[model samples]
Target: MLISSSYATSPIQTYKQSETKPQNVVDEAPTSQGDTVILSKPALDLAAKEKGREFSNSFVMQVANQSNQKAEEMLAAFTYGLNNPLIDISSLNPATGNGATYTRTGQPVTDASEVLFASQNESLLKRNEILIAQEREKGTSAATILEKVMQSIDQQPQSYKDKIDWSRLSS
Candidate 1:
């Protein structure tokens, strides 16, 4: 008689490998020897240029979204460096002769004021229309055009001396 014996096999043995640190891990902290990396001049300049470009792009978008009237107001404010133009009558003390108080007379000041105002308004409207046409022709936004214009202005030396020379030449 042949007897077959079956014995339970040892449960499958499993062993977890020990964890090892990654080979590429870097220690970025400055060394006690005071070793540090400094940005080169070119890198700094490039960073500054990128920042200026970003600011210009943002400014252009802001200006582009504005209406014609709003754009004109922005232009005027930038040119004059004044956000709000008001008479500020409260600051006027007539006794000090620092400010003049106006009295409404039956006669209006010379009709020239009206004419000048109309001409100036017409000029601004025409300028804005031209700018709009240029923007359309270039397939670009007003802000981009304005930014280019501003850059050109910035490149020119606009010191007091330059202004005096310009005035002399014009006169």
Candidate 2:
């Protein structure tokens, strides 16, 4: 005669809400280190409606990182195209460590102060010019890129939770 035994592994755990806080349902679910939280489209739309356009745009850009190429691809999904947009790259004052403002679709301006600024940091000015030119060539406006990122964010689930080891808790 022979005896055999089986053990359960990785079972889903459920918790009962505390009596003191009956109204609050606390869900402690285990999440892996690589897990990512994605926002739903309805949630994104709700955020945009509540926060306004500027905040939404800034939030999307910040989350997606400042890459014009990425932004252009996002805009393309929305059927938006950027024309040969002109970007104004102003010079910076090396002494004060200031003056690097770039504007899309604007004429380049150069004042006496700007001339001094550009001369002080010619390499930096040149790099900025190149980056702006490359972005313009991608054929999508910054606003449109931001909009696409926001839309993409909405397609993801936005909740993350960590499970607690019940064995460690004192009764």
State the weakest 10-residue window (summed lDDT) of model 2: 160-169
Question: What's the true lDDT of residue 82 in model 2?
Answer: 14
Global local distance difference test of model 2? 0.34
- Predicted structure with the largest TM-score when compared to the true one: 1
Tens-place lDDT digits, model 2, residues 1-171: 011111111111111111111123346978887778789999989988755434343433443346766544433422221111112224545475444332311222235434543343344334444544565689757654444433332322221000111111111
- Compose the digit string of candidate 1's lDDT tens values, residues 12-119: 001111122212325586586557678999999998976555325443336544765554444433222211111123334557533321111111222453344345
Q: What is candidate 1's TM-score against the reference?
A: 0.27
Candidate 1: clashing pairs of residues = none
